[model samples]
Target: MVGIIGYGVYIPRYRIKTVDIADVWGDDGEAVAQGLGVFEKSLPGPDEDVATISAEAARNAVKYAKIDPKEIGAVYIGSESHPYAVKPTGTIVAEAIGCSENMTCADFEFACKAGTAAVQTCMGLVTSKMVKYGLAIGADTAQGRPGDALEYSAAAGGAAYVIGEEDPVATIEATSSVTTDTPDFWRREGEDFPSHGARFTGEPAYFRHVEQGATNLFKKMGTSVDDYDYFVFHMPNGKFPVAMGKVLGVPKEKLEDSLVVRHIGNTYSGSSMVGLARVLDIAKPGSRIFMVSYGSGAGSDAFSIRVEDEIQSHRGEVPTVDDYIARKTYVSYSVYAKYRRTIKA
Candidate 1:
């Protein structure tokens, strides 16, 4: 079966609370936090960036997979916050994880869903027998203009998955996607931060694409919401996915464990993939997981996955998602500004 052989996630150690951010701007921290359903967001250290985060996550995946990196024939890193405009982050990741020189490598950017796009690419390659394994990653050091609405949720982190046909931790049963030419969000060529259409990002962009993607996947798989044991969606904030759950009739318990955004904020490309990792961290064999990722531009990729018995043996080898969430140090807004480079000398 072409599925996830192993998965790993990396969240930055630093965090900045919503209240701290709001305090600087003279907004009501309690009101802002409650509205967005976000308490705090992650912050990349001055020495950290997309490349570093991707490499760390990739190494963890390699450890979890217990496979020779030389066997991985493809590597793809997806993010909007790649440190370079002209270079590929995939090469750095492949080399960092000790992959063979004979593999193909590239980067992807489709906003938050780019990582799932890379995962789909790996699925295709593995299913075709073109490669024994493929490494897919989603990571970002997301940018938000100081005091903008996005500053409260735009955060940094990453996740990596190793896809192969062997003893997989989770088997992918089906996948589908939906796309539209919606102008809900964008960052211009020279712009440091993205611009959004505010509420337009909700109805026409994220919700429309994600709902359609899930609907299409259900149709393709001949299943419904109740068939899955868990559900995960791209969490631009804690509120969007919960609201989506209500719209889709998913029970609160089924979607609760994946709401990492409540603490880490939005990890952009890493959003849904990291949520999936959290679900997989706790899921038992035979548990079914339904996941959908949304990207502004815009599009969504949905997948139906079933946990395998192999997960029990491999999941404990590395730190769980909760471990990363618990290992954090809060940063002041001024320190955060400096780390994020929001303040000029």
Candidate 2:
């Protein structure tokens, strides 16, 4: 079966509390934190960017897969915050991870769901025998205008997966997607930060798309929420996914393990991917995982994944998601502004 041979995640160590950001903007930190359900958010260091974050995650995946990088036939780096507008971020990642020159490479942008799109692409390539193995990464140094609500949630992180037909850690049973031309969020060509439709981002965009995508997948696979052992949904903030779980009839326990957003904020393209990694960290063999990722453009991609027995042998080959979460140094709003380059000279 074609599926994930290995996976890895990277979260920047620098974090800023939601309360600290609220204090800078003269808002009540407790109220804002309660409203968003996010206590803190991550930020990149002065040298970290999407490319570096992606490369690091990919290297970890390669290490976990225990395969020669030269065997990877395709590389896709998906992000809204790609370092170069003109060059493909995938090439840099491929080279950094020691991939051979003969592989195909490209960059994908679908806002927060771009990474899942990459994973789907790799799945197609491997299933078609067009590639022996493929690498897909979702990473972002997400942007937020100072004092905007997004400043509290826009964050940096990434995850990578190695996909192939070999003995995999998990096998993808099905995947589905739903898309529409709803402008819930956007950034113009020269705009420094994104703009959203406020309340419009909820019902008509994220919720509708995610619901439809997941429903379509359920219909295709003939499975219900109770069939899955774990659940992961895109987390723009801590609240949306929890609310979505209720709407989808998923048990709270099924989603609790994947709630990394409560501490790290939204990593844009990396959001649901990192959450999935967190679930994989503890899922047992034969566990079924239901995942749906929403992108604000807007759309959602749903996946049905079943854990394989191979996971037991590979556990702890690389640092777990909790390892990164625990290895943090808190920063103030001013320091966060400097690292994010939100403050101009």
Candidate 3:
């Protein structure tokens, strides 16, 4: 009976247009729009970091779950870009959320899919009666080399979900995980930005894992793609998921409602988790959701979710994606550089 009890999301107040990058780099504007499907990306402010953003999202999750923070029994932070190499960001978030001192806390990192991994792990803890409630968070401050195509779309945001046993808001119907021993994308120690085989990133990294993961979940669940009302993927940029969704035979009608890879760029670990939060907000009871998460060390996790009747009454109030995006303050490229810590004093 372990399932998600609540969910919340946070996107920074600053936004950088993809066109701003195109103008400075003298690149094609259409490529930025058509190829990527992202017009703007959320940018974290000077005072924020992975821990701070995770804390904010955790607080909101507490509100949504209608649970006292002291009752939380575990906290997990999932990120590829943790602020400290060794310290657990989950501890900082737990303190901010006011979770008990006895709570379990740790961090998980497996590229973009780490967030889903955190959710799976928390489910195990709650199902085993080890925890009354737990929180899983995905957050990142991704970096891209200046002038690189990735710069325009790799940005920051976070999402949080509370997992518990009874009175679940959404039930996890089934899940499947697939792995491949390949390097579709990677960044070594001391490297500020990741490197990728662009074409391989599509076929081998993103498409292959998502396809296999979803297929396995559908097979195991005795359901097909047509059974789900919506599909959400870990979108690094907009084009990859759109193209893959088309090839995978997901109904075009189902995809029109997706929010990933659109309003916000990829949040690395936060990508699919935030999409899941958005889906929870709009999905009707009895609707099935298919979620596919991919990480570049090359793995994917797929989960089938059924919205529960309980969600309609308890879905807590939080800022909508439209509201958050509308609140964004546009900044100059120079200011973007300064905020990103790319400017040399």
2 or 3, greater by lDDT: 2
Which candidate would rank higher by TM-score, 1 or 3?
1
Q: List the residue pairs that clash in candidate 2.
A: none
**What is the per-residue lDDT of model 2 for residues 162-269, given as tens digits with 9 covering 90 to 100?**
999999999999999998899999999878899999899999999999999999999999999989999999999999998999999998999999999988999999
Return the TM-score for candidate 3, rounded to 2 decimals. Answer: 0.97
lDDT of each: 0.95, 0.94, 0.85
lDDT accuracy of residue 148 in candidate 1:
92
Report the lDDT of model 2 for residue 114: 96
- Superposed on all Cα atoms, the candidates' RMSDs to the truth, in angstroms, are 0.7, 0.7, 1.2
What digit string (tens of lDDT, one per residue) describes model 3 on residues 168-216?
8999877789988879888898788888776788887788899999889
Query: Which has the better TM-score: candidate 2, or candidate 3?
Result: 2
Off by over 4 Å in 3: none
Q: What would the TM-score be for candidate 2 when compared with the true structure?
A: 0.99
- Arranged by lDDT with the best first, the candidates are 1, 2, 3
> Whole-model lDDT for model 1 versus the true structure?
0.95
Cα lDDT of model 1 by residue, 1-345, tens digit: 899998899999999999999999999999999999999999999999999999999999999999999999999999999999989998888989999999999999999999999999999999999999999999999999898999999999999999999999999998999988998999988799999999999999999999999989999989999999999999999999999999999999999999999999999999999999999999999999999999999999999999999998896788888999999999999899899887876
Candidate 3 clashing pairs, residues 3+ apart or interchain: none
What are the runs in model 2 whose C-alpha is more than 4 Å off? none
